[model samples]
Target: MADLVSERASEAKEITRRTALERGAGVAAVGAASALAAALSSSSAAAAVPGAKAQDTSSHSRGTTLPTVVAGVRIPDSQLTRAVTEFARKVSSESLFNHVMRTYLYGSLMFDRRGIRYDREFAFVAAVLHDLGLVKAYQTPNERFEVDGADAARNFLRGRHMPAERVEVVWDAIALHTNVGIASRKRPEIGMVSAGSGLDLTGNGLQQIPADALTEILAAFPRAGFTQDALDTILSLCRTKPMSVLMHPFAEVGRRHLSDFQVPTVEDLLLAAPFEE
Candidate 1:
């Protein structure tokens, strides 16, 4: 445990607060989304999840334009997209905000490559706000970050008078983006967002992605120390709210950092249950 703490301390030192702030600063202001779009048609924007490779060898294409449209659907400047980005950017750290952006771009590209049709607008909203729970504004002890983000997203959509069905779709996408196998089988939009997140964090399905398209997205958004930034968020939550870690992947962070943390396995749950006499 001491060794783990020391190692984490060393890693944190390597990624200084100033360095993380610089990455956030690098994201062009919201108005530039359209300009970014015109640039690559144009590109993208994340995070570390456990068991996922933190390294990405792809070079980022630096661009001032943030794409308003991607994978043949309008994003960024759309009503829901705009609301989510504006709210998210205000509350989320730069690294997290950028992660959401990359989620949209990577998810959109994945769907396009697979001949799958999706709701681009919903994807954009879901991707941008997927991590809203990480931001202080939405943090709560009662629910996991995913649930907080989903609730916040649904409210945002409802406020805009979006159809309830569409709101539900976006809500599901945000809630399920981290659910692995289950998400990929839900609505097409939900599956894409989840799959896109996997691609960015772990390079899970990288082979299916065209090299050129990936390059363009990275060029615009840049990883910018995303892995470290995201890890920080996960670890912080684990220390502050250990109960929330039970079912989510972030539980790994809790198990590693919290001394009393004990993740219950399937057998443990079964033995503890109040079944049969």
Candidate 2:
């Protein structure tokens, strides 16, 4: 536990320092640091279960076997599923691919608990491709990583002949998964993707889930340093494309992790807006 805490603390500090140096925005750095601190605190609290010895699965145990069922439901193994799985595996590390799988499982479980009718396949697609921008193949400089990921998902589903509305839903879900408060109010598909990822990433909604259910999910899709891997992935993207993070959801995170990234604040944007005095 101490080691986990120490590792998270160091990761947070590095991200915060980089973002601060890159953007030269003290305020953004402070905000990013606070958010990371809160995430670490929430994660530590969630792990306070009885007899919890291991914080995450060891590297040796990863890829040994993945369960066929999660959260009391059998995972689908369609052609599309296989394609998406292969695409993500080719781009992401094993740990990140597992994280993506858990995102779907957790999202679907949340919908089931609410008695809501959700398109399980849609959730699966959205969650599976949610982090494409973090991979080198999908990285783009013109938009936020979320938008880039959304575009990639949109293109993939288009090739599969998915209906326009369904593809749009997946696109929106992936694009807005990082947005808090708003995603939950959108379509069920969108809401679940956002909420599920949050729960898996930071334990933000972990309290609402049954302990046994969470235990089952983790046992099936173990997190092998997912926290560090995710942070490192984000930092790497910011490093490669420092300006891309200027005004996106990860703006503050970027400002904290890169020494060369700088962007306009809301006030600056307002001053520069058209029709300004």
Best by lDDT: 2
Tens-digit lDDT track of model 2 for 7-115: 4334334555544333322222212221111111111111111222223322233333345677785576677776776555544555666677777887788788779
C-alpha RMSD of candidate 2: 12.6
Which residue pairs in candidate 1 have backbone atoms (N, alpha carbon, C) closer than 3 angstroms, thus clashing?
Answer: 33-66, 35-65, 36-65, 36-66, 37-42, 37-66, 37-67, 46-99, 60-219, 61-219
Worst 10 residues of 1 by lDDT: 34-43
Q: Write the per-residue lDDT of candidate 1 for residues 81-100, one digit (tens) a residue.
A: 65566555544444555667
Q: Rate the local accuracy (lDDT) of all candidates.
A: 0.58, 0.60
Error of 1 at 9 (Å): 34
Measured on C-alpha atoms, candidate 2 has an lDDT of 0.60
- Strongest candidate by TM-score: 2
Determine which window of 10 residues in candidate 2 has minimal summed lDDT: 37-46
Residue runs of model 1 more than 4 Å from their true location after superposition: 1-65, 68-76, 275-277
